[model samples]
Target: MSSDPLDDVFNLEDRFYTQGYTQGVEDGARAGRIEGRSFGMEKGFEKFLESGRLAGKAIVWANRLPKKTAKQKDASEKSSEACTLPPLPSNPRLEKNVKLAYALVEPDTLSTDNSDEAVQDFDDRVKRAQGKVKIIERMLN
Candidate 1:
């Protein structure tokens, strides 16, 4: 039966402070998680959009390559065994075209001044890209 009034008061104050500190930490952690998720999703969406644009341009350039002839198709089919793949042509010109096409569409290749821009001034850029694509297409001839 030791009822020390000062000890009770100190215990009460300590308990209240601990409760408040725990709640604050939990609230801060929750907010941080929400912000982190939102930031990640926004960045992911931007990357997805840029990848789509790059793929579209790459597809246009890829279409410039010759289609597989019947003989090539048969060759590919014959090599369709498990873990086996058909070989691509050993043409250095084809390799050069592929590298140039990928370089043209790669996000990393964007100019530093425009890298962080939200909206692109794409009219002139698009025309120049099309001109490059045309040159690559002609190279296939």
Candidate 2:
């Protein structure tokens, strides 16, 4: 109680400043992480759309599904299995590439929480899938 008013005020100010600075840093870090994730997801989605992987998958799946006869489709009791699965690729290389491409283009693969990592991953996946798709298209053609 040997009152040094200036000392007390300085202590209080220093404490407040330290607390505010720490809180601000934490908040800024959290915000940055959220923004990074959002940016990554948006960019990934754009790449996914531009890649045409989904559309190609749809075409492949549609082609694989068996067509029903008009009369069979009209019957009250429909067949147990609506779509008969197609045979797997007999060519080893083609099968491997097909599997890799499908895996790369999967929904899970398109989303990442890190912007830089996501963009790089997206680029690699897109290139790999596109290459596989080209191979498949050539085979089909």
Candidate 3:
């Protein structure tokens, strides 16, 4: 009756705007939850695949190598050389003395030896050591 059209118009617009804002906020929250769940699922699946691949690789490595005694493995790692178990022969005598010569060629364990004989002995031991390693390598392939 007073012709306060401006007040009515402002009030109606404000109500509409508030309703629109509330709807927008609810829609955004739902969308964010969906995106977050999707991302989490993807990461979990990726980790599962990576772990499966590693397990498979470990199986392959275990199959290729014989069941080495802990002592042999430890000794090999300590000596910085590959330790391998040869095939079991019907006659133990037929098997060559695989560990015939011993000398510390490992740079860490090498002792000071001034004599020529010691040097020659060390060289021959290394050669025999290398031959044994070669035999093991050939069997692996």
Candidate 4:
């Protein structure tokens, strides 16, 4: 077997090109994976920030509610001691208005019908009755 010096150099260029191509593909995949991970982490951080803000607001509101309710209870107790509760009147208008308001605001009335049309009808009735109550309240005031 005669060894030619030029035979070894013949496929060296093809091998180098193939190796370079494989390395480029691997680098591109690595970059893609890194970018994807970064994007996912960014989304997770945003959700965390939003939830943290909502939790902070909820805590602030929850903390203030007890103080306000306590003040209201104290005021009511003082007023009640000073003046006895007025006897409930047997007025027909008061009864009718209260019954109408109760019917409009009741969960059972609104939720009884599962159909969309029935729900719309219930909503319309509730709104109409609410308007009437507002008018009656204004007249009383």
CA-lDDT, candidates in order: 0.58, 0.66, 0.50, 0.56
Scored against the true structure, residue 39 in model 4 reaches a CA lDDT of: 95
Off by over 4 Å in 1: 64-141
Ranking of all predicted structures according to TM-score, beginning with the best and ending with the worst: 2, 1, 3, 4
Worst 10 residues of 3 by lDDT: 93-102
TM-score of each: 0.44, 0.45, 0.43, 0.36
Question: How do all the candidates rank in terms of lDDT, highest first?
Answer: 2, 1, 4, 3
lDDT of 3 by residue, 1-141 (tens): 967868977799889999999999999999999998899678645544443443343333333343258987566465444435333333322123222211223333432363677556545545555564456335445
- lDDT digits (tens) for residues 66-113 of candidate 2: 344777545513442463554333465655556666776776557555
The RMSD (Cα, Å) of candidate 3 is: 19.6
Task: Compare candidates 2 and 4 on lDDT and give the better one.
Answer: 2
Best by lDDT: 2
Q: Which pairs clash inside model 3? A: none
RMSD of 4: 14.9
lDDT of 4 at 73: 67
* Better by lDDT, candidate 4 or 1: 1
Candidates 3 and 4, the one with greater TM-score: 3
Model 4 regions more than 4 Å off: 1-16, 66-141
